[model samples]
Structure formats: C-alpha cells, structure tokens
Target: MLDASGYTVISGPVGSYLAERLAAAIASRNRWNGCVWLRRPQRNLRSLDAALAEACAKRWRADTHPTDDPRRRLERALLGSPEGAVVVVEVTDLTTAIGRLMTGLRPLASDRGVRLVVVAEGLRLPVVRFAPDALVAPAALGGVDGLAARVGLLASAPVAARRLTRLAERRPAVATDLLDAAAVWPHDVLLGALAGRTRTLERVTAALLDLCTPAQRSALETCATTGYWHPQLDTGVVRAADLRPWLVPLEESWSWVRPIWLAPLRRALARRGPSPVVARPAAAGPGSPDDRRLRPPDDRRSRSTGDQGSRSSEDQGSRWTGRGVVEVRLFGGFEVRVDGVVVDFPGRRGRSVLRFLLTRPDRRCPRDQLLEEFWPDVDGRAARNRLQVAVSGLRSALRSATNDHVIEYASGEYRIAPAVRVRTDVEEFEEALGAARSAGRPDVALSAYHQAIDLYRGDFAADVPYESWTLLPRESLRLRYLDALDAAGRIALRTGRIDDCVVTAHRVLEVDPCREDAHRLLMRCYARQGRPHQARRQYELCRRLLAATLSVEPAPETTALYRSIRPR
Candidate 1:
C-alpha cells in the first residue's frame, strides 16, 4: 500500500515477480498509478496487463506503454492526470526505456510537478535530462518485508507520512534528481539567460532564481559557454559581454576559438579604451625594406647575443642535435630512440610527455592542452610545475643523445623541429599503405604492406587504459591497419600469391576475428591453394565468433564463401 503523494519506478525483468509484488502493494494502497515501459510488448504483454488490471481494481489508474511510445503516454499521464497523482513508469529494458525517458519525459518532468520512477532490473537508475524526484531499485526495496513495511507506512497517518518522506529522501533515488538537475541546468541556462554570469543552461536558471553560486560556478559556466579565457583576463575584471561576439561564432562552429580569438579582441578593446599608445621605432626612407624589419635586426642581434651568453651559462642545454630519426615504437612498450640509441629519459612523467609529443611530431602542442591531457588529476601551479620538469627532462635527454636541440619552445608552445627525422611504426604503416594504393606493381605493394602489418606487434600500448586523447587515434589507426592487411590479402590471393594471402588474412583474424573481409579473403586463399577443408573450418570459426560476440548470424557473403569452399 502506498500514498497519493509518492512516485515510484518498478524496474526489473518483466516476469521477475518484483513487478507483480509492486503492483499488488500499490493496489492495496489504492493511490498509485502504474505505466509499464517495455521494449518487446509481445513478450511481456500478458504479465504486464495482469499487473495493470490488479492495480486498477484497487482504485489506482494503470496503463501499459512500450518504451517507443513513452512521449505520448508520459504526456497523457502527467497533463491528463488529477493533482497529486503518483505515476510508476516500469522500464523493462533499461537501455530502450532510458533512451525514451531521457529524450521525452525529462523536459515534461522539469516544467510540470511530476516525479519519475525508473524500473531497471540491474541497472542504476537511468540518467535522465531532468532528475527524478525519487529512485527505487527493486533490490533496494529489500524483499517483501521492506516493501510491505514502506507501503504500510505510506498508507498510515500524517506522522508516518513525514517519516516516509525522510526515508525516501535518503534513498539512492535522490541522486537521480541531483544528476538530472545537473544535466539539464547548464544547457538550459546557456539557451535561456540573456545576461549576467550565465555560462551553462543550469547556471543561467540557477542565477535567474538566485540560487547558490559557488566560487567555481560562474567560471565553469563561462568555460562551458564562452570557452576557457586566459587567466590574464581575470573574471574580476572581464565580463561575459567582452567574450560574446567571438564566443558566439566559436560556439556555433564548435571550435576551440578561444584565447586565439581573445588575444586580438583584447588588443582591439585595449586600443579603444584609455590605454596609452607606446611610440614605435622611427621609419626608414621609402627604399628601406619594411623599416620595422630593419630596426628589429639590431635589437635581434643584441637579444641573440644575450641568448648566446645565457646558453653558455647553462650546463649542457644542447641535447637535441643533428637531423637523425626520432624512432617511436609504440607497441609492447613505449620506447623513444634518437637514431638507434635508447636514451634514458628522466621520470615517468617526462617519458609520458615525450610519448605525447612523438605521437604528433612536428606539431605545436600548447602547454594548457598538454596539462589537460597528461596531468588532468592535478590543477593550477602543480600541473604547470610538473609540465615544466617533464619538458626540461625531455630537452636534456634529446640534447644528451643527439647533441642538437631539436625540441623548439616558441610562443607558449612546444614542437619537434621540422628538420628532425621522426619515424613512428604507426606512421611507417600508414606510409606503406599509401604506397600500396599508388604502386604500379600490386605484388611490390603487398610485400610493403605485409612488412607494415608485421610492425604492429599489438594494440598501441595495450597496457595503457582507454584515455580520451589516445583512444580515438589508437582505435582509428588500428582499424585502418587491419583494413590495409585485408585489402593486401585480397590482392595477394587475386595474384595467386596463395601463401602470402593466407598468412596476412590469418593475421587480420588474430586482431579482429569477426572481420568479414579477412574471413572471405582467407577462405578464397585456402580454396585456391587446394585446401578446401581449412577454408570450411575458417568459416565455422568466424560464424561462432560472430554469434558469440555480436549475437548475429553471418551475412550471406560469409555463407556464400563457405559454400564455395565445401568439398565437392
């Protein structure tokens, strides 16, 4: 038994018995309304209908709507219902149900006085746009005793009502509300708030309503809406309007056109403001090649002299020497070699720093970007100091090994010099694949691709966890490399290079067993090489792997390949 005031989500497998018990309890109370959200109505239709009927008989209005029809049902239930009505939305399949609820119910719940109960069997409450007022996992209901006791309390007097409210607030259900509010607020504010320190939709709404604005709240909202402003433009001095023109275009394009656009804007604004103009060097006559360049040479010479003296003062600053290859082997272990010698780079942090640089060699890596990628857990001065130490160690290591300073620091950025020979196995693999596409001889290209395939010992730093920066490129390169092998294998088989084709196809399968192309290539290679049994066996293995991993049968192409290889 439950009261008219509370909302619930009856989550679990359709015939898990928990749904029936929840229905019976709600029925006894005669105050709750039930709505079952299921993926496949045909499977759970009978049981759910039975539960709905039982709840309805007890004076609780009940309905069943498939997750696909959530928007219609939720709108009908919320807007159409009498005041203080309790709606229980049963989500039989968590994924489908969550998707529907997040897309539909969240906005409705936010605007109206409605509470959502997500019934997912084993899942934590589905993350919705607008947080649910309460969350009740069937397991947390703690069997029949806890469920009955809570229901009985809900049916009791006003004193019991206060206790029930307190208990429900303590439930994990409250987290749903908090997270939901957090999810929708920022975006809502960004779209809603026209002025003030509104960075996110959440902050705008919270500011409009005059809720708690934590020290970082405005800053976070600014970063979310306007992009990260340079620390030089301290929030104390700078306002949101100062950022909007550039921010609007950048936000529209979804480009990080921050600090980049900000610099020019700041200079323009400063010039327009009450800032004193500094005098420039006197111009040379018309014949002089840009007087600015001529005046700068004398100043540049003096600065160069100063830099030379400073360089002499420092101990062994000339480490990155000569135009030699910076070989980065990023399979098995993360290794960096200048030419062929394995230089000892100081600190694990420094090694990681170098690895990041080597991955995108000859490109400018900003200090902030590096800090965010590498020392994400640390913040402010600590992260900066760590980066400085790592950069110093990298410079020292390169200088000691090669006797040439190849890593150039300029304009608050670090880059591997263009002249330096940077050779990564990944890069080499890409190069070989490029050659294969253009080479006049298919066999020559196949050989080069095979060599490239051999270089990929394993997943790029397989030991490393999935990082936001590395995962995308790593997976992309890995997939591309595998595809190249598949293509090369097909070419090899077509050219009657049976042994080479079989070897390369097998290698492809080792990395990705369900690669349909690899399976087809291998089958064709085996059959052409007079190995029908092996071809059939390969098909069976692929079929099993596909079924196990993806829960789907092999495509017609795969079965066709097997049929072609069957013993006649």
Candidate 2:
C-alpha cells in the first residue's frame, strides 16, 4: 500500500473472497495499533442509526463524554487508535449512506492520517457513484503496487483462488484481463469470463444491462454522462437503485455499477456517437444574455436537488449545493446578505475567519492550518482559543439565516455549511475569468470577459487588503482583471465600440497605471475619437510611468505607437 493509502479498491475474479481475506490478512499482522472490521451485521440493523450502532459497537466512546453523530464518534474512535490502525467497511450495507459515510471518512483521511481500505467486488463504490469531495488517493488492489498483500489473501478461499491461479497459469492473459476488468467491472464477472465460464465482453455487458431495469439503465446513463451521481437527485429510480447491494455510493454523490463495462453499454446505447443521457439546454438566442451554463457562473449556483447537488447543470461542470443563500460580496466591500437583506456578523475577527474560509478553494481549513495562516504571531493555544471564540461569534450572527451549525466542525476542521445558497463575488469572479478563457468563439469570449469585468467592481477583499489570506486570490484576481480589461478593450475597438474601448483601457490604467498595452489601446481609442492631443498625452503618461517605475525608457512598441498617433 502507498504511504497515504486513503482508499484502496480490491476487485478481481475472486474479489469478494479476496476482500474478506485481505481484511483477515491485515488482521493477522500484529503491526497495527488497532483494526475495525466493518462487515454486514450478523443481525438486522435496518436504519442508519441501527447500522452505525452495529458498525461502531463498543469501538469508540470517551469515558467522560458521549457523542451522538456517528461521524464524530468514528473520528473519535480513529483518533484514539494508533498509526497503521485499519477500518474495513463492507460496501454492501453502506452504499446508500455514502454522503454521511464520506462526510465522516474523507476529513479523517487528511486530518487524522488514517487509512480506509474498502473491499468491494468491483470498481463501483458509493464515492465514485456520487462524485462528492473525492478522497486524496485511489488505488486498485489487483494492480501491481499492492500485489504481494493480495497474493497472500488468496489462501483464504482455496478453491476459488486455486481455480483462478490455474486459469491465469494457462492463459497468462487471463491475469491481465482480470486486472483490467477488476478496475471497472466486478471481479467475479471478469473471472467467470476469463475462465471460459461466461460470455464475451459484449454479451457479459449485455447480460449486466439485461439485469438493469429501464430506470436502472437510465441511472447508469446519467452517472456515465455526468461522471458522478448525486442522491439529492433522488428520483424513484435512483433511490430504489441506491438500496441494492450492487450500488456503491462514492465520496459525495458519485455512482458506479460497472464503470468498466459502461463504455460498451454506452456504445451499444448510442452506436452513432456521444449521445448525452439527458438533453442539453438549448443555446441562448441572439440578443439574449449569455446563459450561465455557457458562461462562467457569475450568478448564484443553482439549489437543485433534482440533479443531486452537483453545481454543473451540463455534462461536466458545477455542484449544486443546498441552501447557503447568504451571499458575501468581497469586491467593492465586504457585505453579508441573507436572502438579499444586509446583516452584520457579530465581531471583528468573525469576518476575517469567514473571509479566509470563503477564499479557500476546498472550503475545509483545519484548525491548525487556519492558526498558521491567520495567527502566526500568536501562541498555538491562544490562537486556537481565539479561533474558537471567533467561530462562535460568526455562527451566532449567521444563526438567524443558517442554524448555529452554519459553520460546521468535524475531524479537526471547521467548514461553512451556510444554508443552501451561499454566493461570493470573489468565487463568481474567478469562475467568470475561467469562462472567458474557455469560451470557444471570439464573441463568446468577449462577452464573458465583459461580464467578468462588470463583476469585479474593485480589488478582492479590499477592506482586508493586507491580510495574508487575502493576498494570493487578491493578486490573482487583479492580474486576471487586468487581462480581461485588455482583452475587452481590444474586442470593443475591433467591434467599433470606441467609447467602450476608451473606458476599458482607462479602467486598465486605473488598476495598473504603467500598462503599455492599455496605453496603446487608449492612444488608438483617443486617435479614433479625433482627440489627437489626448492621444499624445496618453503616450507621455506611459513614458513617464516607465521611467519612474522601472527607471528605463518605454518599450520600442510604445514609442512607435506614440509616433503613429502624433498630431499630423
């Protein structure tokens, strides 16, 4: 196993037998501090509470304190265990509870240094199926890296192991096929086929497809098309399918049945080409505002439960979140709005903490990481206490809009769970910048750039300009804003929008007073506006800025542009 073996998938012809043995083999080794085997209960535990009671059974409980959330209890359990301790969760019972399960597990992989080894019959897991925040590492068991450990596990089931080994000995390719299929399909199916006990790939896939009802087929198509399934999309089909032993809930809302066999099924379903399982939204008509789907999302993210909380409305973009409607505008100034109404957070440091978390790409900042980032000058104990206080103040203020748990704590990290619809101008600005760059057509690109420019009213977190947390994104957005200005200026000039060009170039200089490109664009816009002296004055400003800033003459291009615009 890799050093940080957060997740390992074991699958092959005898994958089920091997999965159990793999756990057993690890159990045999006395090197670990502790181990928890997560098998389906010997007795029935139908509800999640029941299942957790069974899964957790006497493993984690503080002598002085008791916690109810299974996720928290598991974290406490793992924290109490020493390094190299293992938890083997049976996929069969836990597939439907993927989100709750991953919410507990994913944070631990990073914060606790724990390794979760999942033994499944195939590549399908609840994590892959849902496409939630994926774990850091994903390794296949039949693959080369962990081969020795898996080889020893084969002895647990002599008959299946011996038969598979014999088949591999004769064909040799059987071993290769077994690994390949194990990556995507069930190990048993691959083993049966390679052992000449089943049909060809096409028929094997078709047989699997035949087993799926239309609803199941549709669900497979959706996850395949979208790359992950979200349970919030909880249709009758998806919900029913989720309960089955075959469905594995991955990280967040990802889904997979036999991802390896999906390609052939997709091909068979659409022999013509890439036919999306769901119909795409029609393009906006001429004179229409650019659709958020077609552009970077400047608007608030959709709160659609129908699509499983994934923001992307199309084939591959976005995760729809629940109800964080408290929008924080970080552009011109800092303003927290709940449902479009302005509200102030309780204390001074509360805004800083919220700003830091809002700026983080993943939104999960460990308590220690936050201390290092925001309070490097303070003592560790003091900083941690300060953070706790600030968290309380922030949550207190946000409690009216969100619950007291809007700022959530788990596994040594605190993250925002601010209702369902939370939006930040900074996040939207970055998204717009990306959309502008990725837009295919020049017009589309120009439109996106213009939209991005409009969204960026001022520098990022202008109120907290000097904060360490604000500097990186602030500068990044500043550079991107400059680029958008330059691009938009050119587009305006080319399209005969001279006034817009002048405004855009002037705005560029407002941000970076020495930008020769902006100076050149202004010179042209001024010359085109028949303001020759103004054009010449723009060149003089560029020359002086170069001399003052860099102590050197303006570039040859600037001088050449100045000469071109001389009053004549």
Predictions in order: lDDT: 0.50, 0.56
Error of 2 at 198 (Å): 95
Q: What TM-score should be assigned to candidate 1?
A: 0.42
lDDT of 2 by residue, 1-568 (tens): 3233445544333223445346435643332335666654322323543444434445544221244554455555656655555665544323535434544565665566656655544323334542242332221334332332343434444554555555444332334344443444454543444344433445445545544544455555444443344453333334623322223433334443334444665665443222222222323442222421121111111111222212223522222223445567787567776544456676768888888887676676888988997789999899999999998888777776654366788899988764545677677767877887898876677767755765675678888877866788788888998998888778778978776677677677767888889989988988999988778877876887788898888889988888887685
Assess candidate 2 and give its TM-score to the true structure: 0.44
The candidate 1 region of ten consecutive residues with least summed lDDT is: 291-300
Instruction: Give per-residue lDDT, candidate 1, residue 561.
Output: 75
- TM-score of each candidate structure, all chains considered together: 0.42, 0.44
Q: lDDT: which candidate is best?
A: 2
The true-versus-predicted C-alpha distance at residue 131 of model 1, in Å, is 75
lDDT of 1 by residue, 217-281 (tens): 33223243233333322223333333332332212222222332334433433333211111112
Off by over 4 Å in 2: 1-323
